[model samples]
Target: MHTAITSQPLPSAAEAALARESSRVLSACLQTRSDAQQIELHDEQGATHPVRVPVSALRLLLDVLTEIGAGNAVSIIPIHAELTTQEAADALNVSRPHLVRLLEQGDIPFHKVGTHRRVRYQDLMAYKQRIDAQRHEALDALAEEAQRLGLGYD
Candidate 1:
């Protein structure tokens, strides 16, 4: 019953627009994926929406689905648990260098057995939580600012 998104505040007009645009683009992309299986989203509020997108549709959605589904609310079966540096970076929605910085910061624990850095499943989940929280905070702040300025989505 865990969600990637934490409720703090609403999203701003710009954030909403960006999300809408991204959704439109993603919907188009998902429509194009031959293997994209429509996923049915059942929100905690008892709302349900169906979308069929494959793992290759984009890295983020795949990771989200993986995270939610990995826990008590496991969506689909978990994919790769142990991933390489590039793969972990892709999953974290960041570049390799950024992930390395996170690794150095100890935001995510990694192992260097030999010359390769390997990120574990638990580490990836923690990183996702941190990333999601920051996004939520930014969107919340942006929305509040927009409201204070009388900005409208229309």
Candidate 2:
């Protein structure tokens, strides 16, 4: 059997880099100064580059990176709590038939608990999170365009 890629962080160098990045992320977040100027990104060479991003985007970035570093990233997560197809579908906000299609396509992992196929609850959550992120991105694009055009948002 092939060795599983443990979700655990890799060795020292990678871990250190992640820590440094996380620190920068935290610093960016802790900047509560009003009249916030444009964000200045410091490069490895100590060169400062100004980049303008909405505060909302920065906050979202902080949240996503923090979650990933905490091993709680919305990506595929192995779960201990097992659930049947119907249960998994409900957890994922999809229909049982849709889950069955995913099973047939070998898109999701599952085990046969005696006769019924079962999936991990964490896996269902991870899948839903992934789908939600994609939907959010598309909606964000439309919203951005609407904002740019001064079009109807409500």
Candidate 3:
């Protein structure tokens, strides 16, 4: 079964408050680099339950909360997950055929599963980072060349 992942709605007032609190807690806990911490949750029944959370998980939660606090929707995807070419293309914001060409050229790594290519989420992210770095370097070089020619913005 396939499940669609979508960004969540903006946080409500109460949620915003919780987000603030979570951010504060995360900031404090991250400084100590604690392995795990237990958080108390109080339900409508007035019963408190303690749940253990890893520091990494808490950090991710804080990031999500911060985005929501800023009125931005957020969604999470695991880095190790496998993705189809179409899904990878959608994530990369490119046409499927373009992505296929990239795959064919070995620009992005993929493995075939019964004739269907599957890309790892981490691999795609790594490729994106590489492309972004290359783009940044090229832009920097262009700016330097323009500056050398006295064509830079005032």
Candidate 4:
């Protein structure tokens, strides 16, 4: 499997401002009923070029712009991509050893590549969603119990 890791520095204040403006404009443009839109780009030398972009791609670009405008870093991973233990751990915000334990315990679906283990991005996301839902359920139950006990929880 071919995996590409890309890391970019956070946007500067000026860049963020530009991203905010650009996203706002793109959002307005996307309200039209069309599969594709024509957008114009201006070069540094005062040259203009018109390009047609698919609506789906434009929507994705808008999302990226919005995140950058909010000063958040973004990374794109294909659903079918295979990730290393460290990469999967980083995606789940957990330690590598913990991810390894989960893999060994069959908590998440993974496969062995020779002697190394690789996790599919889709399987990892599914595991994360399941765990998050369970945590939410537990929290809700705890809150309900607290309310029943009249512990002054609003």
Winning candidate number (TM-score): 4
Regions of model 3 farther than 4 Å from truth = 1-21
lDDT by residue (tens digit), candidate 3, 9-111: 7778887887778788777767755698888999999999999988788888889878877667787878778888888888899999999999999999999
Q: How accurate is candidate 3 locally (lDDT)?
A: 0.83
Model 4 stretches astray by more than 4 angstroms: none
Please give me the total number of clashing residue pairs in predicted model 3.
0
Error of 1 at 146 (Å): 1.2
Winner of 1 and 4 under TM-score: 4
Which model scores highest in lDDT?
4
Q: Please provide TM-scores, in order, for all candidate models, with all chains considered together.
A: 0.46, 0.44, 0.83, 0.92
Backbone clashes in model 1, listed as residue pairs: 12-143, 37-52, 38-51, 38-52, 39-51, 69-74, 69-75
Per-residue lDDT tens digits for candidate 2, residues 31-81, read 875433367899999999998776655665666566555545233333566
At residue 111, what lDDT does model 3 achieve? 91
RMSD (Å) of each candidate, 1 decimal: 15.9, 15.1, 2.7, 1.5
Q: Candidate 1: global Cα-lDDT?
A: 0.65
Better model by TM-score: candidate 1 vs candidate 3:
3
**How far out, in Å, is residue 80 in model 2?**
0.6
lDDT of 1 by residue, 14-40 (tens): 655555565555545564536556667
